[model samples]
Target: MTSQEEIKVVLLACGSFNPITNMHLRMFELARDHLEDSGKYRVVKGIISPVGDRYEKEGLIDASHRLKMARLAIQNSDWITVDEWECQQPEWVETAQVVRHHYEELISSENNNDDVDTVRVTPQLKLLCGADVLESFGVPNLWKPEDIEEIVGRYGVACITRCGGNPEKVINQSDVLYKHSKNIHVIREWVTNEVSATHMRRSLRRRQSVRYLLPDAVVNYIEENDLYSEESEQKNADVILAPQRYTCTN
Candidate 1:
């Protein structure tokens, strides 16, 4: 039984977490540190986003395995917990809807005993995203023009900086977003690491050492499952080298 005063929550921290990495842990620590230093809201938990059917990428591992890996990686962190609701959904859903629903559920649960209760409900939600996603905000098909209102109007977002993109582009585009809803906020911290899941996968297939790239648990999981074998690596290399054959669709 947790006390109401000890239930402060912040930052939804959503992501595929395909294979959790040191970067992910670093971001969590940074967010918590920021909240503490600012002396504002006390962050009580970090929510992990499990993969759903809506992912556009091809050749993803099973969600169960991914979820297991995420759980293993965060096992030592008492403040972080895995949220499997996204992966468990029976149908595909939009990102905006997911955000709204999660907050709504939190609010509803908090007020569940309102009939004769003296409990005050306090629910705050923040969306965590990478800079790449922020740059692509104009194109999140999941978010309709109005859905943006529901999101920024109701919750705050934490944006982490990533490479290969300009922050100004994201800010300028966000002007239009602000017109719709003003609750959106961005974090300017740059993660500095060039690690990405695609590169990790490629490295694994090539039998290259991925030390210090991904979390130890994820590396172990990949090894135990025999993921990304040498044959696949060779095939990928061949495809990259032999690539220029475009045909006329007419």
Candidate 2:
């Protein structure tokens, strides 16, 4: 058996993260825990990259706000990091490119390392998504075939099955994905709250309490910044006065 130090694994999650619900963070945690429990892999880092504004997903806020919210949500965790490169892109970038972008960075850093340990192996990069996103792969034109091949075939994918998501059926349906099926890891979520960003937004719109549904700091950040509220647009003054101010400083 290989020693823990010999192998490294990192998960890159790309999504709208419009307000970043608790489930978004749980996917990373669940994936990492599953990988670590396998004994053959050592989880290293996790990255959260929100989609750019150009994608124009309905109810999605500016990338900067989403990015800040993501950062705030992960502040307490030492291993997770937020990458802004995706949101910074001038045009709408596909999800595969987002995964590759960070994967290449990890490779580049490893190449530049002057103190390489002979026993340490190269890190493994995998795209992290919920089952819904994985199911969407079969949705016509929802994801480009080339992009899907590049992501799952190359870096691979780690998914957490959400309510009503059937990874097995989807894999059985897609020839491209099934070809690299060995690279895929799908875990059924157990303990975490199954919250959705869309649902959270709707709750906010209805002026309902979302406390504890998400990271407290993130909830506060959402409320303090007036994001997702029905009248949030009317609160632009505060949003502008301190657009970057996040509720959690930890």
Candidate 3:
């Protein structure tokens, strides 16, 4: 590995983003702030890769809608952008593949550089996730062991603890997570963010207000499109927003 100053950091967020929440956007800022504060890594890019329509998750809207809403969620952030590659997939793309895909793009772009003498180091790809996503990792058959190794070993994670979820407990308990603990950066929120897409959707189902929970642009888009009008069928029982499950798109 190159020196921290030489290496770059790219944050990739893979999710359904059924309706991106404020904390979704805040994760990038908080991770970036943590990296900068450490004087170790420089954040070069932040990409929100919404799961495709084929992800087949409950309450998941159309890929087109999710992509646009994700774009709107990060329109103002210069370093942050939305990538449709994952969403365009015919089936759900695993998290490891998503990270590798972006890393490959970086290498390809660097290869195209005109300067022959200049050597470019690939930017480190790290998944920006909430504690909920981390929690799901250990679930039986949720993620492949090899994928877990790549996700936490090859590409690391920056997890934001929501509602006082203790990420370290998960990290310290799991062998894979514990082995790659150095790669994981845990950001603890003194004031836990209780917001999530499921909560927003449930609120919308009941005709409740969701303002300030998500981006203003997203709020306007959701209203104009009249999304989440139909009551949730709760197809994925594990996906429901609860105190224990903080909603991770998976």
Which is better, 2 or 3, measured by lDDT? 3
Error of 3 at 98 (Å): 1.3
The C-alpha RMSD of each candidate to the native structure, in angstroms, is 6.9, 7.1, 4.4
lDDT (Cα, tens digit) per residue for candidate 1, span 123-148: 67877767665565566443454655
lDDT of 1: 0.64
lDDT of 1 at 227: 62
Determine the backbone clash count of candidate 2: 0
Model 2 residue 136 lDDT?
75
In the range 23-64, model 2's lDDT, one tens digit per residue, is 788888889888888877778899988887666555668888
TM-score of 1: 0.78
Q: What's the lDDT for residue 20 in model 2?
A: 87
lDDT of each: 0.64, 0.79, 0.81
- Candidate 2 vs candidate 3: which has greater TM-score? 3
Summarize candidate 3's per-residue lDDT along 1-250 as a digit string, tens digits: 3364545899988887988989888989999988767778888899898887656677777889888898898888899999999877775666777888998988898888888877667778899988878887888666777888888898899998866478889988889999999999998777667887888998888889899899999999988988886644354435633212422224
* Ranking, lDDT, top scorer first: 3, 2, 1
Off by over 4 Å in 3: 1-6, 231-250
